[model samples]
Target: MYTTLLENIPMLFNDPTRDFVAGIIDAEGNLQILKKGSIRLVVVNTNVTILSAVRRVLADIGIEIAIRPYGKPKGNERQRYRVVIYGRGNVEKVLKVIPLQHPKFFSIPLFSSPSWGRKSGNERDPRPQLLPPPPGGGHIGGTAAV
Candidate 1:
């Protein structure tokens, strides 16, 4: 019976193109809202190490993830987890890898992300400034090229 239900669950939502990826990051908050008639999953942690450990477990379960690791808006220092799965029994399987100590779960939704962008510090160097416009047709300081 479970297999039949699982097969019918429609894995299409896991596709990377869908907006649902956002819900996975805000999974904690949006899980309830998105899961109105759908399956929900949650992976919880405030520590980077713990969160990473959870993600690795998911990877091992054959679910390739596109992670958007960043600090919470409230400045609570908790990193968020948002990803997509590529295989079956993912929710059930990932739960097996995570040790019972760390409270993260699949099959139940949680707060996730709406888009993917690396955190500020993690971005490339910001030291170099953009080159000024070309000497000819391009204007500078709001003055027409003279």
Candidate 2:
């Protein structure tokens, strides 16, 4: 549905389009904490057109992003591109404009916290403390290397 719409016409920054982009993010996006403790939102797809449309929608909301080739394509596979929202401020901006309904939703507060990557001691903390697991002791998400 999104591919068809995105390929046919440009997307507006209206509420419906925002929700549509949110759905795309929820399905294809990853909210990640890089090794340096910076946060990013990434959506990967084989279709550059769709990713470009997504980028336009995000730009309308005053958030900047970059579309880059992800990696080498496997045999018989299309090259993947990533629409990335880098840095704490951009990630926060996306969260404010789009309500994400996914486990990634829990990452917003943690990513927005001022002390997210700060060291509490004299030594540089190798692994910043993340939010504790949920009440039932389930995993939240994984961190990505830089």
Candidate 3:
């Protein structure tokens, strides 16, 4: 079943090129909206082949990305390769292509950019909502401070 799927994966998307790029981001990727209203799309995996494929696809489509090592993962840990894309232009490129749909369908509107966000206010709010999600209100891993 896996082999058959692998063989047919390439055919899954062509016209909707964003779907293909999104597949990578969804699989081992993180699309984050930072505090400064910038987009941080991170794709990490042990498989170099797929990472390279992502690079090729994004490059051909004019969204540039840099493939980098995913940092030292402690002793005896498997190192992963990563492809990261930043900034509004790049995120805009992606959002324009596919509307940032897929991965997990959440409350973010299709017309709205999944990566678009507002910068943090310099002055501390007198009363800020404690339980509210992050600026973009999306899935974020690791420790985050409010």
Candidate closest to the true structure, highest TM-score = 2
* Tens digits of lDDT, candidate 3, 91-112: 5465456444544433434223
**What lDDT tens digits, residue by residue, belong to model 2 across residues 9-97?**
64343233676788778888877665445667788888777777678788888887788999998999999888878866677678667
As for candidate 2, its clashing pairs are none
Question: Stretches of candidate 2 above 4 Å error?
Answer: 1-16, 107-143
After superposition, the stretches of candidate 3 with alpha carbons farther than 4 Å from their true spots are 1-3, 6-19, 98-106, 109-146
User: Residue 7: error of model 2 in Å?
Assistant: 11
Instruction: List CA RMSD, all candidates.
Output: 20.3, 9.2, 9.6
Q: List runs of model 1 lying over 4 Å from the truth.
A: 1-36, 69-71, 75-88, 95-146
TM-score for each candidate, following the candidate numbering? 0.32, 0.65, 0.59
Top candidate when judged by lDDT against the true structure: 2
Tens-place lDDT per residue, model 1, 69-107, is: 544656554455444332224433433332332222322
What does the lDDT read for residue 26 in candidate 3? Answer: 64
> How many clashing residue pairs, candidate 1?
18
